[model samples]
Target: MATNDNVYRLQGLSCMNCAAKFEKNIRAISTVEDAQVNFGALKLTVKGDATIAQLEKAGAFDGIKVLSENEPPPENTTPFWRKRESITTIISLFFIIAGYVLYFQLEPKSPFTIGTFALAIIIGGYDLFKVGLKNLVKLDFDMKTLMTIAIIGAAIIGEWGEGAIVVFLFALSEALESFSINKARKSIRTLINIAPRKAMIKRGNSVEELNVEDIRINDIMILKPGEKAAMDGEIIKGESSLNQATITGESIPVHKTFGDEVFAGTINQEGYLEVRVTKRVEDTTLSKIIHLVEEAQAERAPSQQFVDKFAKYYTPAIMAIALLVAILPPIVVGASWTEWIYLGLAVLVVGCPCALVISTPVAIVTAIGNAARNGILIKGGIHLEETGRLNAIAFDKTGTLTEGTPEVTDIVPTEPYSEADILSLAHAIEAYSQHPLASAIIKKAKLVEGKKVNAENFQSITGKGAKAVINGKEVYIGNSVLFEEIGSLPRESKQRISSLQAEGKTVMILGTSNEVYGIIAVADQIRKSSFSIIDQLFKLGIQKTIMLTGDNKTTAVAIGNQLGLSETRADLLPEDKLTTIKSLQQKYGKVAMVGDGVNDAPALASANVGIAMGGAGTDTALETANIALMADDLEKLPYTISLSRKALHVIKQNIAFSLGLKIIALLLVIPGWLTLWLAIIADVGATLLVVLNSMRLMRAGERSSIENNV
Candidate 1:
């Protein structure tokens, strides 16, 4: 079952139903083990060894062309009027008008009139009839098969003008659908075009331009002002302000210096720089975003699943109903054969199901493409739908809502020792520890000029604190529990520690074996966008926003209150956070968890929707969460939720209008009022309206001023 697969690009693959049939045809080939087609991406992947000739033969019915993955897609430079389909449509329209003129001026069945109508049908329906006739032999009842049968029936009933008109209108309808879908697809194509194809590489003294794929890791790439980066790498040489709008959607340019990572598609505004390439071209951030988005577009949501299932039986059922209308009326009701047969043909035209079939996919493709352009990567249609339905959201406290870096805020020393003495001693012991709080202490100590004294016999206690010998005295550093075991703490010191904890500051104690030195308070700064994002979510109908953390209950509750969160769960380990998420799910039907993707993987997997922040910087975040916000800030979260809800609404509207139009047209059969003109117009009009309705999602990516301010 495991084998190397070859992916190929496809041309002229526009219909979802035809794409399915083409995939099946490829699988039937003896040389191919399996094959799949991504209708949204217009790509075909085949397993086993199948020649290009074999694949092309399988797709011949729909006139599809297969190209190697390495081959460049042909540029679409031809004007719309010069296209093959357009030329044929124009000629068919001219012939239909000529035929109608002859019908009113001369005899209705005159040889000239019938000959003109025949030309129109042949010109307009040639491609449709070819594919439809082939599918008909295989008993495939798709939209084309229904239209083909209706056109032929109209011709047999001496309605050449109606048949010719039906052919013209259906051709125009498909053209409109193709145009709208391609407009949606252009959003993704724009992303793929953001990165440059070539880079300037320096080897020893000389620099040469090479393809990005040819550049190896650790190779130095030289970038000049106004140049776009060709690969993902770290800067080793200069500083510049780079516009990272392609990767993070930040309108403002970011300043980058030595050791800063730059993405493949960002633009360098000024200054010269040399970067060390870190990833291959295929593994770059832009490449992964494109791959994920294409896969997301292929994934079906709950509504799409329902529509696909409904269409499977709906098409066959329509055929049976058309058959009964043609036969039963002539027999049981004693109706005229010609009139009822004409009515049956009209019913077939209205029942093509093209509008209903395309309703969900068009909206899904547009919304996902829009999200990607705005630096939000939704992994699947299912997740996009679930995000819109989320009533509750849980947040991880440390890195998600606040800046992860902790800084020392206050220092309290006893009467015998000044603040400087406490900091100097604490810094000596903390120099050997790698804890975050220790870093904060060291940073503060470096700000003042003090003698550096090395601590001897440094030992890190597992859950308590560290102890070491400084100036021939054993000093202890940790929480109150560590010093409590050594000696009793004064009542005033306990009250001071409580005050710092109540302000959401982490308190670190420093002392000797028998006496307390002082306490240092450190806290993480809250992000400026946190309050506004939470408030916006509430206005959008989110009922609850909770924070989960491993910090003390007092600290967690203090921070939660400042952000106006509905609840706070503290002192929770990684697994305990997972349990809390499960509990939230039972209380609220649908819940979402937001976190720094690596540590919160368990809780993220348990929630209905897992959103990861700063995905542009970490590969784990991109792969772990259901939705990845590329920017480091949470400015995009509210916008992502808003877009998903709008997509859901548009899909519902499309489905309702598609079905409503068909029902109205079908009702005309009771009084024999339905004609080929009205039936084809109704069907074509419905399909056009559904496609246009889905296109509205393209404008949803424009960020609000409030979001941009952050």
Candidate 2:
């Protein structure tokens, strides 16, 4: 907020419209250059120099409160019974119960009986009237203001029972609304509390337990078997498998050892670990995820924006129509004033836009929060909605659809040599270089530490291969292109190279300046889930599943055939991968690009939705992609798609249910069949129903990808 200064938690804000109202008012402050209210997450951020005092005062005007980071949450200070809305609702219930006893079990219309009903109205109506009267005085009408007028008008016409019912039902719905929403919000709190507050740090010859906030960068954290990693750090000592479900959403434990990275909340399943902290407590990936997720929940979807726009004009139009229904009938048609006026009040009560206004935000918030818990990050409401509409998704071949690690499958010599001879020389050259296939050749030859051939003049050819001087021989260990540079790739080897490529093996030429010595082939296996995931995408309505890779066409086609991909583009540079994404976009209205989020960053950026793999790049997944499937599991892609489509359907159901129910309730009024109690029931009932319908998303996404065995 203000480039970096202001972030506040909003308390007592359950209505999206009220949050918008407070936001507009805060931005109007001269000192507040910008302001945003995240209704779903209940946060307010401000720019410029607006102090906490200024924001709190402004928010208090609408019964909303702003608590800065340093301030204690309102829940800690205020008891449930002492809260204004809670206290008023409790008091209103008392009077309504007494009024019901007097009317149904005894006599009606006595002064004492009517006085009891009047007490219900006055007690229940106070909170609404406080906010509603202010709005009425300013001509800023909303649901509260509408209810306030309807209740007063009902009591004036001697319908004491209906008036009490309006207050009691309205207050009941408000309580339920708060309860249901807080239930949805508990997911974020649960995630925030995952990491232990204190951690065991390794000091000189001893270990000391300290609060996470007290831990500093470069601190050595000691994690024993079965202990969670204390902070985001590099593993300086020990080896273990880590269950990173909290960050990566993968249930399988990832092996971690010397020089490997570990996150603050991941579990060390075995062995001992000494980690050197790389990030401060607040800057850990988990903390950043929590903050960005909260912010993402605040963004509005297209349907949400549409509802807000519709509510702006719909409320005033309803009021005008209700006025004409009351006064115009008596003036023009000579209809009974009493009956028409009652009908007008019924229209006002039913016409409150509470249900319609809340339809989308609640569902979107619930769905997004649930997705986060399950290892998929739906960044914003817009992305959540867009993901629902994706018809095609392009996958990066290496890390996305296949195991990125390639292994030596074959070693062949050209002339007067055995496989071992070719491997010995190839491993000699590969040992001195860092290439994707270097370890494959070295491991095939069983060349261990202190047993490798010494070499010098090492140079790596990016994307093609590498070269080195091995045992006084200039050996080229790379693809055919490296041999072509030497003015010769023997014609006899072309057939063998073609055969290897056709089998999806990356063929590397082993030769010198004089003649070709040997050839080595490496192949990375396809992931076990790739075939089923591709099939599932089609089952989930994906029109096309394509692969983009820099591998040669023969190898790409070979892998593509095994996986049954709809299409494949091979032998392409990074730029070529990006252009193919554009072509897919032109072919499909909306397509998703899935990659590792590093090398594929350009194509991932260009697609309609970008999904990254692994637990790496938490911030990139946040800032770069619309969605992220943790652990790089292609199975999560279908689950992500299913969740998005489910959320979309739920949102549409809510909007239609809210508006359709209201229209039917209003139509009953034309026949003079709608009563004050019935009108309020329809209005408040829809609000609670809308809220409950949205809350279903909270648990609907609870299915674990691990338990599902995907």
For model 2, what is the alpha-carbon lDDT of residue 133? 83
RMSD of 2: 3.8
Which candidate should be chosen as best, given lDDT against the real structure?
1
Estimate the TM-score for candidate 2.
0.89
lDDT of 2 by residue, 171-254 (tens): 877777776677777667666777787899987888899998899999999999988775799999999999988877778898
Give candidate 1 regions above 4 Å deviation.
79-82, 97-107, 110-115, 137-139, 412-429, 445-477, 483-488, 510-518, 704-710
Stretches > 4 Å off in candidate 2: 1-5, 61-63, 70-98, 105-107, 197-214, 224-230, 269-271, 411-422, 447-494, 509-519, 615-618, 704-710
What RMSD, rounded to one decimal, does every model reach?
Answer: 3.1, 3.8
Q: Estimate each model's TM-score.
A: 0.92, 0.89
What TM-score does prediction 1 earn?
A: 0.92
